[model samples]
Target: MSENKNYQHPDVQKAENDELEIDWMEILRKIIAIRKTLYKAAGVGMVLGIIIALSIPKQYTVTVTLSPEMNGDKASGGLASLASSFLGGGTSSNNDALNVTLAPDIVSSTPFVLDLFDTRVQTLDGKLDTTLVSYLDEQKQPWWGYVKAAPSLAIGAIKSLLTEEADSTAALNPFQLTEKEATKVKGLRQAITANVEKKTAMTTITVTLQDPKVAAIVADSVVAKLQQYIVDYRIKKAKEDCAYLEELYKERQQEYYDAQSKYAHYFDTNRNIAFQSIRAEQERLQNDMSLAYQVYSQVAQQLQVARAKIQEEKPVFAVVEPATIPLYPSGISRKIILIGIIFLTICITGGWKLFGYSYWLKIKKMI
Candidate 1:
């Protein structure tokens, strides 16, 4: 009874026995016996991988990093000035009106990507130079695309026949895209990816294309467009303010000049006169001239400030790493592809050596 009490549970005993009963030596022998099959499978796998790698078009990836001068100081100054105007307080508020974080969203927006369709790129050989849309459409697709997109092809053909003239403006509409536009958009989306890091707040853009030179060109174009877009957006309000101020300043300037002319004419008409009424009228005209001058000076100052604000609000973009045409293509990693195929083939061959014959027998019996 005491020995039985000291004994382990059945499940524990079974597990221990199972651990000892592993047939590693037998498994090794089986593997050795199937060495030739393994070798043949590996060879076939490697050959198949090489064939696939060679068949597929090579791709090149280009990356560019941009750091936007997302300074809250300039934005805050404008926002504070705006808030004070409404709240009747001095322009000292620290709230930032412009959201610097929208950089990533703006870069990835459909309109922005669509704009790049017009960007011109040339092949490294300089033989083919075309817009991004044309390049994408002319690129070679895999054989399976024909089979997979037969329905789409039929629909597009029918639409072309029915419609005499498709509106080009519909291309800009995200929801109602023409067949050509959709293809271009899809290609652009796949080829370009933009992201921002929260830690550093730097925007990283990556472009992948069939040609290295084209990839670099497209990447650089994207950065240029992004900077232009940001600058336009940032200075839009300032520019508007400047225009308004300019008009107001001109009006005030004309009024000031007209007042001066009237005062000067009155003085010329009553030169050396010493009447009390004339003196009173002269003082009144002089006061009017002084008031006009003050108002004109103030408007002129405001106009200058508005112009300065437009310049100050302009965002600066720093290129962390500019896109360069890669010397070596980044696509079709033959070595890795070969290794993966060999590994998969080995697994498949091992299965064949184990249960493949049995499975075939079962299939035969079922038939």
Candidate 2:
């Protein structure tokens, strides 16, 4: 009775400090035991990774690097064709990435992507390819594309997918686009990447294909086609520049003629005192000639630049390191994945041990 009273009395009660002590050796033994039990799951995971790594088809990447033409006046014949137009416009075209930012509302608009269908590729024979007729077939989406989890569903969908794969070629034309050619354009648009280096004339482009040869061909073709596009675009601009400069040059010439004509009339009228006022008149003529010369020099420089651009014969793409087929899979990081699996296994085993401990305590209470 007295012992029981002492245990219940607040004054006699002793406070117990709670502490947890882990036995490292025991924990290690438990972990080893857990691994032995889970050895089958671990083996299954490793096998699955190896199989997945090998099952994926190899894809090759092809790339081209270009040093874009600078907006400079080097008096080169190739650039002279555009100098006038560029000067008139007061600015250059919005760069590749900047196109989206320039018109954000229309960048992702459906009309824009659909409008791409209107552009067609013309072959050397000047006829549209029949391959463009099946453009709508590209819209066939992968099954379970939106459903991320349960990849098996997507695989099942892909097997029976009613999709047409686009065959892109160098002959593809941008002007003769039709409904049939829309799919090819869409596919091309997606597979292509264009990036320009900041504050420099460097541009990089990449294209991917299942066949290594096709990848290389597509990359080279894009480089060729794009050069033509730039040259034509430049030529048109140069003509405009030439026209503007011609008009400005005429205006300056008229002013120069009027200045000369005025000085002549004054000299004839003041012939009696021509020698007396000759110094003042000479100073005035010098100032006018200097101003006229400055304007003529500036306009002449612009005209020369435009002429140079029209004569560019070849596209200039400085090839850095061209892309090659990747030897290792870039999709999966095996070491990182294995480490994650090991961590999860440890958590699950720890939970199981806790569950068993609680069950044993309950059984002892019953006994």
Candidate 3:
């Protein structure tokens, strides 16, 4: 009984409980003990990050905004041309509204991007100038490029041996792109972006490049080219309309002259005759001549209108904001990247000490 009492004593009970319970303070101390190791890992990570960030070339971005001219009731002109007297309202027409709507599609098209590959721009230092395609090909590659370069070289060699063509002339055919030019165009598409606002109908184009001046120049050129493309598309249809109207007018004019000549010949031949048959024939010929004159006049008027509309059909672009030379590089900050890497490294190091060591032990046991 005395032994049992000793075993159940308060001091002994307290000691047993103390042994079973966790010592959070001691665990905290253990974590704090490795603070130097954690900081060293973090410092190493930060140094590596700084090195990587410094190696990457800075890129600059330029943005331009344009408002396409909106014609109220674009289809009204075509409707009027088909039936003007039948449904009389406006004298004007909008035969080329499709060109206005498809403006964005033209900007992002592969052929359009390919065209820009030939565009020339100055480098960051302004000491060197080169084409866009050459610049991208010559500039610094991504970190993973070394891994991909081997496969790319092998594939290129295989393709070259398989391909019979000596040059990329066939690639110039917009429908079939050569592998090299296609790759370049794909990269270019990444650099240029075109967006249109549905409600406001305003277009915004952004160009990103290694050089600030080059970015601005490309963006400005894109806007101008887009406007020109739309104008050309619109003019093509307008010119066709003018040609058809001109041909129709000439045909009608000839018919009118022939009818007038026949009527005059009948009048001169039947001047002294008073027969009912001759008189009826004369009236019919006069009516035919009058109908031909009316058609000729109406067709001549439409020809003039068609010519006038061609001038009106040309697309007008309102430059809301033009691209300007960028003063600063729009790339990720080296300091921020370095600091982030340091912080992540510290957290990982601390976590490894707290929990990863146990996981590693379990993994080792399993192994």
Candidate 4:
């Protein structure tokens, strides 16, 4: 074995030993050499961080939690089913049209977002009172946002010059939106979000805005709107059925009144006549009037049941946690931001000094 090891080339053995070695002393020397540059980078990063943190507007967040009632099998022995049996109509199947899982998509929809524009909003300090759209439009942004938007603003200005400007007061069409309306929709979409917990079926709605009072108000409004939408969707079929029954009831009532009037008139006019033919005519009219009355009464009963069905089908939402105005802003503190920026700057500078500089020199020589 010793002879075979000696047979290995000396250069090959040295190369294997070098691959296993780590030069910690050399690494320490490199870090110490760039210590001054790292300090300067950290100081610059701290100043930039402070400026950025101060420029950003403080945001307030409001959260609302809801427990929506789930739809169950109502096809069994309800008043609606009884009425359907009497009317020879089929029983209603289980209605699971709107699931809690879909709350996020519904809230993010364009129409739902547009509906919130007219909601009234006020600043916490009572300095501003306006529609949500006006409030959102007048919001202040960080200085950097303006710098980034400068190119887009210029492009929009040129487009306005080339094309006819859209009327601000025109009615909004969901399918086709004006540039200003589209911007508002985009802003609202970002500011509001809905999430549902799969295990608990608990829906949480969150709204973030510059003003605390406005955020709370919007959060409440969103809850009310979502509940209303769910209620409307669930009971739509019941309402339609009730409306059709109402029309049928009206026609059946009119027919019954006509038949009774004819029967009464014939009996009064032929009171003294003892003829068999006149008696038969009177009996026929009476039978017609009785049948009409029976039909009308059944329809009236069905109509009542249909009306009740609408209320039965309506969904209820229990608010587990109501919206409240936040006492403090909900974002990273300025101190944390400053520390993070400084640490990141130091790491990047030190890395460049140790590795990137040498690699760059090698590339320059190759070029």
Candidate 5:
């Protein structure tokens, strides 16, 4: 492998058993000899890609931001959850357990995401929002219909071949549809969907619509919904922790009362203050009082912390950036489509060359 030398290493002679490979020099020759054909193929590919890009539809993408809350009570849920772990519970380590990073997992299973998918957003403050409905309306008319019931899952495997619509024609989408419409909204939830990164909690939720605006609306709604979910989860967990500790505090108080009662009775019955057992009993009672007070004090403080945390922890998701409708078409990549076309053209040309070779052999036999 010397820089000055162009010779193949002799040491790897066995590995150099000649094998067919792509000939770059021959490729250049082919390009030069059949310049018109290759040029035509490339031009056709470009034109085809451009047409494909323009004809069907253009897609828009919007990115929303999710940031960790920075309040002092940032991870109350994690703290309570960890304490529960100390008490032998699973600890339920939140993806946002420490409010460490914006957890994609926590946000992914977000009730808000489900809510957005479920909630029908027809208008933005009374203006008709045409985004979701546009996708449903394919051509001149609304493609949606009132379905009596969802079709069987098995129907999909044979769908392209099966010409018939499976569902009853009477169903409608629940959001914009009437009570009767609710029954017809098949798999609408799938349109509005989210993906959460497994180990790292970055989320990407998407909603497909004929209109770019609707896609943005759905994405924003999903983020808002996720925020509410995190807040609710933290509050519920805090309350649980506080409730458990309250019970423990009450128990400690009862123990303190019982000890006080025993001490009172012993001192009252023992008229002789010089009794050694009486003195020992009094000392024990004092020790018990001290321990009980401290236990009661600690529990009270924990209850306060938990309650304050619940009140103060407000989860927020700041959309650092949001998706905007792409001005130009952002469909399947042009390069990919072009590469496919080139490959197919090569195969066709090869077939023609083989046909010519065979014809030449046939003529030679005749001669």
Candidate 6:
């Protein structure tokens, strides 16, 4: 009796079965019906991909790696310690100011980027030999870019006609950059990059440009400048100390010479004088000369120590990988672009046909 109650009507059972079962054949039929549209989409995608690939310029990337000496002070031990004892145990704290983490910001700074404007660059093909600024000003661009920029260029031209012409020959002030210079600075910043690894303190500088040789040259320049910057910062105080000590040494040396001359003259003039007063005066001059000589000698030693400290405080940088011209262009190739476009086209077309069209039909019927 329970089985008979659960059986219900045959029509109701058939409707429930239809709700639970998927119509795989119907989905396939719908996909096949739109196969022609999918083919047209793929064809259009291929054409567009080719055009984009041809319009984009090839870029070469050059990279340089450096290992900076991170130890606080190389001269803190050995002879430096002895010098410190004599110099009142004054050690330089400038080492703490050496922060490799700021390398990225340093590279992107307006001053640093603008300084590269006059840097001479030669292309691999020997067709271009000009400063970075000139090369950038005359750089090639996609055809569509010019089309898109026409309006802006026209507006700028009109503005320039109405405004007073600025002096192009004037020196650039980092604190205040002109509109054109600022734009160039922004482009250069994007072209050059510096990264430092925290755990190893390894610095990597990269320069990307259309010209491989120029990229390599710029990368090398960046490495050299960065190393110099770090070295200068690390030994700044030491250099100042050395310069001060040199001046003090000169003063003490002059006093010693003057005291020695007086002592010699007094001794020679009173050589035959037998008066007790004369003997006392000669002794006093001798004591003065001795004191001056002692002071001068101590200053001379300190000056030498300071000079050594300059050498000691200087940080050493080991170039792990020097900049080299890149052979292959970076970024996606034309083949990859074509394949990607075709793949995306098929996915979109298939998704729309399978779900989007059906949803649209339902909405239209409801409306």
TM-score of each: 0.81, 0.44, 0.77, 0.89, 0.45, 0.87
Of 3 and 5, the candidate ranking higher by lDDT: 3
User: Tens digit of lDDT per residue, candidate 2, span 187-235?
Assistant: 6566556666666656676765444544555566556556555555545
Model 1 Cα lDDT, one tens digit per residue, 1-367: 8879888999999987776766665678788998999999999988887776566677899999988776665534574355444444343323445544676677667798889988899999998999887888767665566678888889988888997976654546765776678777877887888888877779889999998999999999988988888788778887997899889998999988888998899999998999999888888898998999998887776666666667767777889999999888786586777788888988998998877877999999999
Error of 4 at 273 (Å): 1.0
Pitting candidate 3 against candidate 6, the one with the higher lDDT is 6
Model 1 root-mean-square deviation: 5.1
RMSD (CA, Å), each prediction = 5.1, 12.7, 6.1, 3.4, 12.3, 3.3
State which candidate has the highest TM-score. Answer: 4
* Candidate with maximal lDDT: 4
List the global CA lDDT of all models. 0.80, 0.52, 0.79, 0.89, 0.55, 0.84
Higher-TM-score candidate among 1 and 6?
Answer: 6
Candidate 3 — which residues are off by over 4 angstroms?
1-28, 74-104, 161-165, 169-171, 254-290
Q: Provide the lowest-lDDT 10-residue window in model 2.
A: 95-104
lDDT of 1: 0.80
Name the better of 4 and 6 by TM-score.
4
Q: Higher-lDDT candidate among 1 and 4?
A: 4
lDDT of model 1 at residue 212? 90
State the TM-score for model 3: 0.77
Q: Which stretches of candidate 2 lie over 4 Å from their true place?
A: 1-23, 75-190, 239-309, 312-316, 321-367
Indicate the worst ten consecutive residues by lDDT in candidate 1: 87-96
**What does the lDDT come to for candidate 3?**
0.79
